[model samples]
Target: MWLLRPPGVYRPQPDTWLLVQALHDAGIPRGARVLDMCTGTGALAIAAAGVGAGHVTALDVSLRATLATRFNARVRGLPVRVERRDALTFRAARQFDVILANPPYVPSPQGDLPRSGPSRAWDAARDGRALLDPLCVNASGMLSSGGMLLIVHSAVCGVAPTVDLLHKVGLKAAVVARRTVPFGPVMNRRIPFLEEQGLITAGQRDEELVVIRGDRRDDQP
Candidate 1:
């Protein structure tokens, strides 16, 4: 499916490549149940299906996004289930073997940015950790035993805090992959803080991609 460059919606970020590559490298088995949260254009979901995920459920808060996902899936002839629902309120009737998400980790400003497609995708509430926190906290309930959750985000948005939250919820989080890219408008002030905290280093600084893995446990928090 073609990705429409709509106003106020966040377009696909470069970090999405990181997720696709990592998942491809990880070798998800054919017919494995997978869930893609905040699936913007259904890129990751489509990739997963192409790479042999048995069933893929792509969820997003925006109806436009869901439509895009559906269109894309049809174009590729990949059978993906697209759902329009807020990630926070989405309740899975069954657990999945793999859960993937690329949420809006860029903290939103008090005033809204220009109503662009990319803006809508990137802006998040409260330092960009709002969505990440809830996802980690609720992951155990949504993932089956021994299932895994793969998430990608920037280092500037408090990666440590995200790791801590995941651990607190009984998930063993780790940085599976990372890459630096040219920082853009959505990444303005946060870069300095990330550098100060050693999350990003000097010389050619840019966005960092982090992949966190959540281990399954019956006694999860």
Candidate 2:
């Protein structure tokens, strides 16, 4: 798409396209209320608007990202309300019919998440669950009855934990999509640390990304 992201905004990558494709395949309910968490350039938010959502709320903790998202949405003539807020701490007025997220999932050498810099775009705690854990748990409540949530993360972050967490919250959750990709530069640099953490084996250069889908069917287990 024609996205205009300034420096410091996270660009949509393969994981993003996969989630978009999943969104398309699943189809958005007409007049659906949608939320795009950790929205970088508003790619998914614009996509939802383009698909006829009643409302699209896109949010990011980074000011630059929120600005880029607004600019891109405006340039595309899509209706997306952009906000500068952390997804983990956002308190929406109401639950949404659909929620999309492509949060940071890359393992970093840092003991804690990066406070600032481009690293914030992809760095999580050592195990890469800093955001994923909260997201999976909090998203269950953020979703309305019969609503759906789709989030993408690397397998190194533990997809099983995500599914289990969502399930514990009474959302029917499972891995809906997965793709094996060669490690990018960030991942490549962390191979040794990842191996040391037993997340990967030595000489491993490939990683699998998975999208977890959760449905709040009236909180039925």
Top TM-score model: 2
Q: After superposing candidate 1 on the true structure, give the runs of residues whose Cα lies further than 4 Å from its correct spot.
A: 1-7, 111-118, 189-205, 217-221
After best superposition, candidate 1 residue 139: deviation in angstroms? 1.0
Q: Model 2, 180-211: lDDT tens per residue?
A: 99999888888889999999988889989898
Stretches off by above 4 angstroms in model 2 are 219-221
What TM-score do all the candidates reach, one by one? 0.85, 0.97
**lDDT tens digits, residues 82-191, model 1?**
99988877889999988998987875553442233555577765467777888888887888877888889987677788788887877877778888788887565666
Q: What is the lDDT of residue 204 in candidate 2?
A: 88
lDDT of each: 0.78, 0.88
